[model samples]
Target: MKKLTSIIAIATSMATAEVANAQSQYYKKAEQNPYTLVYDGAITKNEKGKVNIHPVKYKLNGIEIAANVYTPANYDASKNYPAVAVAHPNGGIKEQTAGLYAQRLAEAGYITIAADAAYQGASGGEPRHTDKPQFRTEDIRGMADYITQYPGVDAKRLGVLGICGGGGYTLKAAQGDKRFKAVATLSMFNSGEVRRNGFQNSQLNTVQDRLKQASDARAQEAAGGEVKFSGVANITDEEIAKTSTDLYREGYEYYYRTHAHPNSTFLYTTSSLLDLMTWDAAEHMDLIEQPLLMMAGSKSDTKYMTDEAFPKAIHAKNKELFLIDGATHIQTYWKPEYVVQAVNKLVSFYKTNL
Candidate 1:
């Protein structure tokens, strides 16, 4: 009787532990937000390019961000393979452009991961949609660490790709994290520069204007209100043409209409503008000694990022730049031709380097 009681007690404890692990492995509600989004898509499972999408969740800065893992067709747990960590743009999710890139890369024989950044998508963060540069950089590092431990992944053979704001974050990650054998970015945006000065330095050029906006934003926040932030979300057709900022129209078509997901929120705090002004990925670009591939549309208004950072990378020996002549910033996100070019370039770079 005593032996049986002890055995039952141990079994009960083990069951309890498993239940606790399952609950904690997934994200929990932070503050008042209790809902979460799960990507129920398929992933490749067969040699015919069948997909068997798997849910991947990992914690960064104490926030659990959701991710989708695409295992290549004919993926075998017995055989190890190289992997890529993909980061999406600000106000973007894994299902958008990142998913497209991840899928293509996986199809090309690499394990690819597309994750929702902190405070966005199915990721966990309080005060949603708050974009912090440091946290974003940490998110990439966290993904690299997670992928390294996967059953069939070769930790040493890893690379990273970031899109838009994610591109900037990837550059930042490469500067500090040596785990990534190579790094790449597409249509990168220096969020800090653009936030402080506006597009092409059109606004906040003067210290007075910058201070005025800061002061007003603080006052608004102090009055039990959120400061209004602006971007592609606030622009209209007339505004896009008036600015003549290259690729503004393409941005509108992606973020506002066709590819827009119902849960993707665009509102951000105006106070974050002050934080963005100080964010610069190029600050330590020279420190990154790994192979770097930077891609941007030749006519993209955001082309300046590629132009500036690419020239400043002094430590990189194997660096290349591809500027798509007819492509715009948003065009490369989903356009078949541009996507293929970007994915092909990424696969070639990783295969050779990693």
Candidate 2:
């Protein structure tokens, strides 16, 4: 009888704990805010003589794109300022790390703009969360198009910084777009290689199986059937804890917990894999004549991607690969020490090359 009672008690405790976890948010929503900047130290209001956030919208290939352009303190319309186009990670929105870096660069006197990919985040598109390389690469080019004409921007002095999967697309974009005089990547991720072969090639055996799933998803859309989505919509704390790789485990915590945002998510249209699987970010590396800088966490599990793409830029007359000491893949996103190192290095690189 005592054993039965204890079992029930334990079960009740577990249930209560799960309930609490479900109701709790790691990052609470700030009340009465015009902009949705969720990262630490985000600007609550636009104040003069300080870093100001301007929420702007523009049409990208006929689809409206939501973006935040950060202008440096005391920005004047007539004065010339160097500009940077920042690309967010695969599942990230402009309100997360991309905003953090944009704000940081703005603080350093550079005008930076970070936008959501057309089919994702607060942007508008049918069958939302479509993650395609071509669309993403165009997003980077779109930033260049918009920022170059932005007040006080010097088109010739434009630069770009892409994080995670954005890094991969930036490489492809720079291959053809000569507007970005300097190109840099943070914790670069080769989306095509990973999507086709799987993370670290762990899903290599299931590549054909995944491709079939994507094909089926596309067919469903064509037939006006249910739109199938892939990737995690929601993750339990327990599931996140059990995740094996540092990239995925910390990524879940970052996107779902610590730096959570409403518009950010892990899921993408399964059909996106159809284009993602066959594309490679490192292709046509020689076409990028601009100076390149690739930075990655030395201890990151995904550092292999950066390593693979860095050497392929053979034609970059000036190219440097920087390693942040003792930082993991996700650590570079928010950890203060790591972020400072990356920002400082980036400032120097852009100053020299841009």
Candidate 3:
């Protein structure tokens, strides 16, 4: 185990150092953000007069969940402010895109929080990498629970933004969680649908076989046998280079190479499929009565999910679907122009509705 840790450390350090050299001008200062791995426009602890980041932890269902809260510049606790909860994507933590969006929203004058899901990242849970749908949805609710009571937060003006798979769970969470006055999603990925039928419905024939695999894994646990796990355990640089899909290609670059963090992983327990395979993000979509804003890249292959889910929100009090022209799925996370457009739309949507 020690040898393995050293090897991973060497590899990740080498990767990040290369990135740092390519980005040498951005890191002229000695200090770094204590809470996040370096990425494009990542915040430093001092924030240099931008929003301030507060690293925090709170208990959710007996597990300690790690999160970062971003407050507006020159924040005044005496005055109430609108707040937003940003949910990270699958295989993501608070320090990645979630934190990026949280910080940007804070700069727009909204208090925002991005939290590591329990059992993932820096959060506490046994049998790490348990990616159950229910737990993920609860994680969003848990963020709302924590941020509403934060100093200077106006609970009545609360909003939420969920990215990728987190966007799917956010839809279900907002269906019944009334505290969030407005709900938004970016590049929403429906995990359950993909897990059951495979990406692009390419695995439609193997649905039952996968279900049996999950069932057997669950049975192993019941018998006190070895814990079975599944999912992408590792990726080769060559594989990433060879991949043709923009989503997977750029996703590997973002999560494993460029913006990699020790807490993120592509693995999850096989038993988690029991819930994930049966769930759908658009289920009970009519339950959401709050204002809604769903955005995605017009050129994203994953745009189909957002398109399918958006029209289902027929009963939403108010709703809009904005596509970032010419952007792909992963580009929205860090590309300067897309990120700027997303933040602009988000600021406007929240301001008008919240």
Candidate 4:
């Protein structure tokens, strides 16, 4: 018993140390880029003959939503175009991977919009960073609402591509919202399954304990007390290196070191787990009757989520799971070679479906 207790203590200490580091290792100032994008090859200026980005805002449930709409080079509003809504990952803003994919899709002659989730990033909501599954799903629907109405957007040809947690929410959105004729997910992650069961089911035995924590947090919020939070605010280089999974180790480097953005973070209100714990992205997979394209890095630790969810879409039309050889989860986010492969696959998928 004594030796077991010591092991638990050491594990706890390591986890704490992982979350107690200083600010992001490579955070970029919001003023550095005119559009506040922090990814490589981001658009610095909007030119007439080139791909153009337009900063846009709309109301979702009375809250202001901030987004970037990218139009293809030499775009003409008078002509119809297929539009895609790109959903960012958990803790991601519209300016990171989502924006990168949005921009790339635009370059392929598709109009794309990447929006910050409600209650996160530049979007308006109280008790910021409330990461609820419902809100995230609604954000995708809202994107469809706004983009379908944009000039030259052909509503019948609309599609969506979601990354990581956003991919889960996109699945939820595409289930009921038929506006999205084609659905695709890159590095798909099932947020609820991971939250409830822990990554790789490592916390299977502590499910009740974490639920209690979430319950307590909600009670505190109800009493107007302090709002509790979860997730890492910062991580050290040593911690990043020690992280066992490629998903998290590479994720920290991408979000906090390599492709850092001022508005991106890994934090969320603890009370959100009340809703998240009981949700599952693959709940009604068959409801997604649209053509589906699910892609993931072959070497990603999170690839299991995609594997588990893809086969369940029993009724989906032309559903396929494409693996990017030798790429991990985070690599799909920024690595040029992997990004090119994913984008090419996306273009081909969207072209055939949309």
lDDT tens digits, residues 1-354, model 1?
112111001122122443334333332311112123222222323334454457778877678979978788778878999999999987788877887788788879888888888877888986666677887898899889788888799999999999998999899999989999989999998877666566676655453465466567768877978755534333333433454445555655465444555445455555655666667877888988999999998768789978888988998959999887688898888878878788888888888899
Candidate that scores best on lDDT:
4
Q: Once superposed on the true structure, which residue ranges of model 3 sit more than 4 Å away at CA?
A: 1-32, 47-49
| lDDT of all predictions | 0.73, 0.87, 0.84, 0.88
Task: Please give the ranking of all candidate structures by TM-score, highest first, separated by commas.
Answer: 4, 2, 3, 1
lDDT of 3 by residue, 144-220 (tens): 99999999999999999999999999999999899989999999999998888777776787777778888988999
Q: Quote the positional error of residue 61 for candidate 2 in Å.
A: 1.0
Candidate 1 deviation (Cα RMSD): 15.1
Candidate 2 lDDT by residue in tens digits, 5-56: 1100112222245534642554454222468677778889889999999999
Question: Candidate 4's residue-wise lDDT over 16-126, tens digit each?
Answer: 443433333345444578998877898999998899999999999999999999999999999999999999999899989999999999999999999999999999998
The number of clashing residue pairs in model 1 is 9
Question: Of the pair 1 and 3, which is ahead by TM-score?
Answer: 3
- Compared with the true structure, the alpha-carbon lDDT of candidate 4 equals 0.88
Name the runs in model 1 displaced over 4 angstroms: 1-49, 204-208, 215-229, 232-243
Counting clashing residue pairs in each candidate, in order, gives: 9, 0, 0, 0
